[model samples]
Target: MIRMPAEWETHAATWVAWPHNRMDWPGKFAAIPFVFAEIIRHLGRRERVEILVRDAAMEARARGVLDRAGALSANVRFHALPTDRIWLRDSGCCFVRDGDALGAVQWRFNAWAKYDNFQQDAEVAGFMARAAGARGRRAGMVLEGGSIDVNGRGTLLTTEECLLSKVQERNPGLGREGYEKAFAEHLGIRKVIWLGDGIRGDDTHGHVDDLSRFVGERTVVTVVEPRRDDPNHAPLAENLRRLRAATDQDGRPLEVVELPLPGPLTYRGIRLPASYGNFYIANGLVLVPVFNDPNDRVALDLLASLFPDREIVGIYSGDFIWGFGAMHCMTQQQPALAVGE
Candidate 1:
């Protein structure tokens, strides 16, 4: 049976595309590369960092920045490939393990169904699969990794706003049943915990990664807005209620933890999607996105406690979020396979 591994599980490598499409970051493009380099520096020492570059020139540029930051290391590898944006989590392959065999689920990426320049982004999965010598299979459904969180034990977390709603509908005729079947066949998901809407000002409509996540098989940490007057208060509160009543694939109660939202971060009058829930879990470290908010310490402390054995490091993302994503959005983990596989 093919099963998707949990984020906290051991990783073979982390895939990230070098930021080249400056249009995504608008006025804040120059600083985006430095942010990615900083993230790579932390991840390179832990596991392989597979970086995608559009061409040789782009790779050299990336190398210069990484070298300047003292991040160029033996653990970092580059692949020349075309890309439209830097959000690899949604565009990249979802690796699975079936016995001793490694596989890649090449889901159809439509740029969250919100953009028109995803032609190159859609091919990322297949390319990654070929590079890793994995058995590649194209999923029938158009799904993004950011839209769902799996426990690696058959349970999954997603949102109705991103999947079911007509606004930016991913699959035209596929309903909850269709999605659950796809999850079961591909990711080995048996139970699905459907949450409500996502955080406000999130471009991907309601990706669950920005709202809730599975920290463990029976543990989930979700974002909550304490201010009832805020627009995100009602939706986040409802999602928390669902999590409290939710169960895992084996019908056990889930231990729900609350993570506060980094108070509204705005750039050019637009509110960026800044949440402690967007943190990325690596092999030996957890990279969290901090927005210079008062809750930065609170979020870091809570995640540190949750991942006691793993080092927790916060990356300042005040400029990165302006591109409509953070650390988790930019990285996709490749689960390590069994020895001798």
Candidate 2:
């Protein structure tokens, strides 16, 4: 059994898959790698960054871009492995800690609701875990890294839309109770807090990172769209209300932090799901996705307050969000040390 660790802890490295597929990006594929490279720059400063490439040729191309952008650091390394896409948040290993040792739970990746072709991406977990020198355990159940959040205690935050759906066929025999047991054994999670739905434009079928996130133990930062006419207004409002009413593993009420959603961001006739809730926490920094909107400052200020010790930096995600996700949806973390280490 493998149990995922909390995001606030130390990390040995971060995992990212280089963006290469133009089909996923349509005509804007050229700009996406630069965005990824910028993120790599931020991550590489603090800890090691392991980037997955299709082959040596792709690695050379990515390296060239990184060099041009001045984004490559000594901590950044490349792995020439084939992958379906660049979103590591969906296909990477979920790192956990067992006593003092690190273990990984390799969940079945199906390209989120089995939307895209993910034959190679599904095998990323095992490859990433082995490269990171962690024990990998393959779980028959399907899951995504962005779908679940841990408090470093025993509580997990997720949405029913992603995990409970029968359409994806990830969990055929696991009902809610069965899921609880599976999570308990594999992830060392004692309680599962299920939210009703995710944001509207999310194609991943309600990843919790887009709707709600655990900022701290017994505390969550949720996106809120106050306009009743807006599509996400009701669902996000309901999620906030649920967080306010929910209790943690200690039987205490959760402290809910309300974060405003950026106004609708569109590109090439497509409205992307851009929200401030999808921020990634790293070793010494919190990388947030900025939509080039006025609300970017507000979101940065709020997240900065959340993590005073760590630096809060926001990168323009207008081009990156075109793929329907942002920074948090593109990267995964590996813990540096376990709880007892």
Candidate 3:
């Protein structure tokens, strides 16, 4: 049986693309490359970092930045690949394992159905699968990696806002049954935990990575906006309520840990989705996005307690979130095969 491993599981490598589309970041594009370098530095020390660059010049530029930042390491490898954006969590492949075999679910990505320039991003999963030398399967439906979080066991967490809503309309004719069947077949999921709407400024309609994430097989850390006046308060409250009432695959109650939001972070009069729930778990580290808010300490301490064995590093994401994504959105983990394990 194929099983999609959890983010906290051992990873052979982490996939990330160099930020190129200045339009995504607007005027704040210059600092973006350095932010990526910092992320690569931390990840390269823990596990191999597979970086995707546009071409030779882009790769050289990335290397210069990495070298200058003292993040250039032996574990870092670069691949010349074209990409429209840096959010690999949606464009990259979702890897699975069955015994000693590794597989890649190449789900269709259409820039979250919000942008017109996603043809290159659509081919990313196939390239990722071939690069990892895993058996690749093209999913029959459109699904983003950030839309669903699996627990390596049999349970999966997702949001109805992302997959079901008519706003983005990822799959028109497909409904819950079609999605569940696809989940069962592609990722070996037996239980699907559906949450409500996402945060206010989420560009992908309502990606669950910004709202909730599975920290363990039966444990999840979901964001809770406590202030009643805030736009996110209602939806986040409803999601928290659902989590408290939900159960896992075997009907056991889930241990839902509440993570506080970074308050209302905005850039150029636009609200950004600055969430601690968007943290990425790598081999020996947990990279969390910090908005330089007061609650950064609270979120860090909570995640540290949850991941006692792993080092939790908070990256200043004040500018990164302006692009509507953070650490987790930019990174995708490749689970280790049997031999690597």
Better of 2 and 3 by TM-score: 3
TM-score between candidate 3 and the true structure = 0.98
In model 2, how many backbone clashes occur?
1
Ranking by TM-score: 1, 3, 2
Predicted structure 3: lDDT: 0.93
Candidate 3: which stretches are off by over 4 Å? 339-341
Could you tell which candidate, 1 or 2, scores higher by TM-score? Answer: 1
Instruction: Provide TM-scores for the models.
Output: 0.99, 0.96, 0.98
lDDT of 3 by residue, 82-162 (tens): 998989999999999965788999999888988999999988999999999989999967999999998888899999999
Off by over 4 Å in 1: none
lDDT for each of the candidates?
A: 0.93, 0.85, 0.93
lDDT of 2: 0.85
| Candidate 2 regions with alpha-carbon error over 4 angstroms | 1-3, 167-169, 338-340
Window of ten residues with lowest summed lDDT in model 2: 165-174
Error of 2 at 12 (Å): 0.3
